[model samples]
Target chain A: MKYISEYRDRQVIDRLAGQIASFRDTKAVFMEVCGTHTMSIHRFDIPSLLPAGLRLLSGPGCPVCVTPVGYMDHAIALARQGKHIIATFGDLVRVPGSTSTLEKARAEGADVRTVYSITEALELARTHPGRKVIFLAIGFETTAPATAAGVLQAQKEQLRNFCILSAHKVMPPALEMLASEGVKIDGYLCPGHVSVITGEEIYRFIPRKYGVGCVIAGFEPADILLAILLLLKQVTDGKPRVENAYKRAVRKEGNPKAREMMESVFRPVDTEWRGLGMVKKSGLVLREEFASMDAAGQIRVMVEPPVEPQGCICGQILKGIAAPSDCPLFGKMCHPGNPVGACMVSSEGTCQNAFKFQSDG
Target chain B: MDELIMMAHGSGGKKMHELIRNLFVKYFRNPFLESGGDAAVVPPEPGHIAFTTDSYVVDPLFFPGGDIGKLAVSGTINDLAVSGAAPRYISAGFIIEEGFPVKDLESVVRSMAGTAKQAGVQIVAGDTKVVNKGKCDRLFVNTSGVGIISEKHTHIATADHVKAGDQVIISGYVGDHGMAVLSQREGFPVKTGLKSDCTPLNDLIGKVLERFDHVHFMRDPTRGGVATALCELAEGRQFGVLIKEPAIPVREEVMGLSEMFGFDPLYVPCEGRVLIVADQSVSQGILHTLHGHPDGENAAVIGEITTGNWGKVVLETIAGGRRIIHMLTGEQLPRIC
Candidate 1:
């Protein structure tokens, strides 16, 4: 609690809040592009601290929320085959596919395991050599390096039974698409963990081409407040530029070794997002050298046609054009227990966070 | 003698008799159990009584601070304690998988007897069943307890007397038992030296009830934790509960591990702690009594019942912000990041 509690100091947060509240009035709408940021914002009840003119919107940052239903069907297809073990992040197991979820499949006797890291998935393969183990690799750049490292470890060990179903995505392409699609936004609060790997420099293009302010932020209350204050200052001064508010973790150049490792194992390709359809060079797949370790190339299964849930406006919510409350099925038919969309499944999802932490007061 | 539990052990044959005499009786010897009857015939008590039962199926039967046996006994006793009763007798049942180590079974039974004796409760009756391999986990335990409560303390059990301005007091820290079990299961190899707070709270609760006259309600924050318990207390009620975030006590290790796993300590479980709601005037006296007990040394006033925000539990965050704490919907999953 040393580093964490210090950042949550009441006096420091109050002083920063007072500064933001007293700053010159500017009508600005900033979007935070990370699921953790969305959770932190609500957990701290940050909306009450901001000025009436300033608004913050959630972006397509949750990897679980962005993963397409087709990918889920493909994974379920593999699980139903009874020849492979599906290892995935815990939240993905509850995501509803075209027909069923991985959780339901598991309840009916499929070998689906939730792991904290890819290393545990590889370990399963090492122990259960007779069965194929597929790691459902899904995340932004913050998690890609670990998946890349896992693939390399598998190759070095010549793990014939281990492979990965890569749904990994990069942040820049999604941001580029959001900006080019003409979504209204005055600034962006970049993800802290992703920025730690991709560095603050990757966001330079946003301010250069679109003239939007970008600030890399940590997930603490003080860190988020400071980022918002900086963005307000940028909007008031009419100087749109990239800034690093989370100096403790993020660097300008980022971690070179992790980026190199990811590049060596994966190559960029256009992929489908649940809400935002195919963006150019947004997805990562295993390179030709590691093709044997790719589950998509190693296994084939029959998948039904993907179908979207009826009256679910998750697509509009992800594009930041609609609030979760704007959807017809917001709380009536889309509660967390019986989630109709991916956004209601993951804890970091905008709707789920709002449902769990938001108050009428 | 066979070094493992075989199918014949559950067949009620000579092996079963030998097991009863060699393990269960050796550890759980009492006048009622020595009769070898089908049920425990307890002496009649002359007051209102509390009866409760609980089942334990925790993975890795043996954890940092306690094992399945200790947990089974402590859980049942705590249930009766929170009802403002003095636990007097308990019954244990075991469903074990075939081929389990005889030494492990012996140790589990021994632990149960040890915990029962320490709490001054007699293990009056018991049953054991063995299933085939893979039919069950290594072991499972169920315990039922009975206790007596005086007429003066009976009002504390129904919780209808709770009113506005009643203070909420919690015993010690939260999330210790939950974090301990999770870390052991994940094999995180974290050197936090974390351990479960799995112990009986009957003595602590009994002392406070004896000293305080305005005690209105009591509950052990078990599976769903303090947050869920508070939510349940506020649901369908005429008033609400407002808790201060910083007032909730949490250990550094629990906080750190929860942060690493993307879990909130508020939603995690606590096995050995109690949450008491009482009148505002006697709150200082109750806190003084709780702090004098070993299990309640870190007691603090966390919140109070309120009139506004009916049927909702709101938290005043570390910063000057507030949010509602809802009942936990499902198992909290580890985050992708």
Candidate 2:
């Protein structure tokens, strides 16, 4: 609790809140590009504490929310075959596919288990040698290294029953795509955990090309508030540069060993996002050496074209263009219990966060 | 007997009789059970009858601070207690696996008897059944209790009685019971020295009801913790709830585990805590009285009911911000009770 309790000190938070209130003059729109940040901002109700001139928007950072419906459909299809055990993180279990969700498939007796890390999936394969284990690998850079390490370990151990359906995505291309689309984002609070792996250097393009201020932030209340204050300072000084507010964890040069492991196992590929369409080279695929451990290449399953839920504005919400309340089916049709969209399915999804924290608004 | 429970232990023969007379009856020796009759025939008391039943299928059969037996009895007692009833008699039924250890069963039964004695309740009648090894877990307990709701406390502790100005008071720290079970199941590497806050709260609740008539609603925040309980209270009601984040009591260790796992302590389960809703004027008095009891020593006034944002519960965060608190949708696995 040493690192956690100190950051949540009410006295420090109040002082920072006062500083943010006084520092802001002109209206500004800032976007937090991590699902964890979105969750923390809503969980702590940071938006209501900020001055009215500042607006915080949630970007496409939730890996579970942005995972395309086709990925879930394929995973569910494989699970329905009863020939494979589908393992995933807890965040992706309830997200709906084209027709059914992994949770529904699980109720129908599919062998779906929620593993904390991909290494657990490998352990499942090791324990149950007869059953085929397919990990639904979905996450950003912070999680990709672990998945890569699992694959490398599987290869070293020669685990034939273990494979992964890689839906791993990178952050830089998506940020570039957001800027190219002129989405009206004035500043950005970059993801802290992702920066720990990719490093602060990956976000240099945001300021050099798009002229938008970027500040890498941690998940704590003080960290986020400090990131906001830094972005405000950059904007007020007419300086567009990337700053690291989460210096305790993140560095300009990220963990080289993790990057090297991930690079050896995965290669960049074009993949589709749930809300945002395909961005070139934004996804990770198994390298040729580890292609045998790829579930997508091994499994021969035909999935139907995904049909978006009627009137769900999750796509717009993920891009920070529309709020969760903007959708007509928000509370009535799309709720966390029976989510109609990916945004309402994942706990870190923008709509889910809004539904949980900003429903009264 | 056999050292372990066999199929013959549930065959209604000499083995079954010995298992009951020696193992169960030896521990549960109340006069009502000593009657040896098929049913517990009790005379009617001058009050409304409150009947509640619960089945405990908790994994591990035992946990840090309590076991399945303790949970079964305390769970039933808490249900009746929160309904303004004075729990008196409970009937226990057991569904046990065929090869379960006799020693473990005795420990569980002894725990049930001990909890009943502490809560001043009687275990009157009971039944036992055995299934094949794979058909059931080691043991499962089902308990149904009958309590008397005196005229003074009748209908007072209902959610419908919650008005706009009612204050929400939690008995003590939240999330201890949940974190204790999770740490055991998930094998969290960090040692927090946390134990399950599972205990009988009927005495504490009865004391509060006896002294305060302004109490409107009472609920045990068992499975879904305080957030779910408050949301349930707001549902279908014409009022909203606003809770202060800093006001809610959570232990530092519990908070640490919660943060490490990216979980909100507000939604963590608590087996031993009771959430009370009372008029604003009597809130401090109720808090003072609760502090006198061991179970309610850490009690705090955490929130209040409001007319705005009807059917919703919002949290005023420690950062001087506000957000809505919603009910949990998915299964928070490794369930404690």
Where model 2 places Cα greater than 4 Å from the true spot, the runs are: A359-361, B11-14, B159-165, B186-191, B210-213, B307-310
How many pairs in model 2 have backbone atoms within 3 A of each other, for residues 3 or more apart or on separate chains, i.e. clashes?
0
B-chain TM-scores per prediction: 0.97, 0.96
What tens digits encode model 1's per-residue C-alpha lDDT throughout A1-361?
7779988999999999999998646789999989999999988898888888999999999999999999999999999898799999899999999889999999989999988899899999999999999999999999999999999999999999999999999999999899999999999999999999999888999999998999999988999999999999999999999999999999899999999999999999999987899999999999999999888998988899999999998888999999999999988899898899999999889999889888535
Interface RMSD of each: 1.6, 2.4
TM-score of chain A of 2: 0.98
Supply candidate 2's per-residue lDDT for B12.
89
Top-lDDT candidate index: 1
Which window of ten consecutive residues has the lowest lDDT sum in model 1 chain A? A352-361
Score chain A of each prediction against the true chain A by TM-score and list the results.
0.99, 0.98
Off by over 4 Å in 1: B186-191, B333-337
Clashing pairs in 1: none
Per-residue CA lDDT of candidate 1, range B1-337, in tens? 7799988888899999999999999999999999999998988988898999988898778888888888899999999999899999999998989999999999999999998998889999898899999999888888999999998889777888889999999998998988887777754546567888989889899889888888999998887789998998889999999999889999999989987878888888888999999999999999999899889999999999999989999998887789999998877622100
Number of the top DockQ candidate: 1
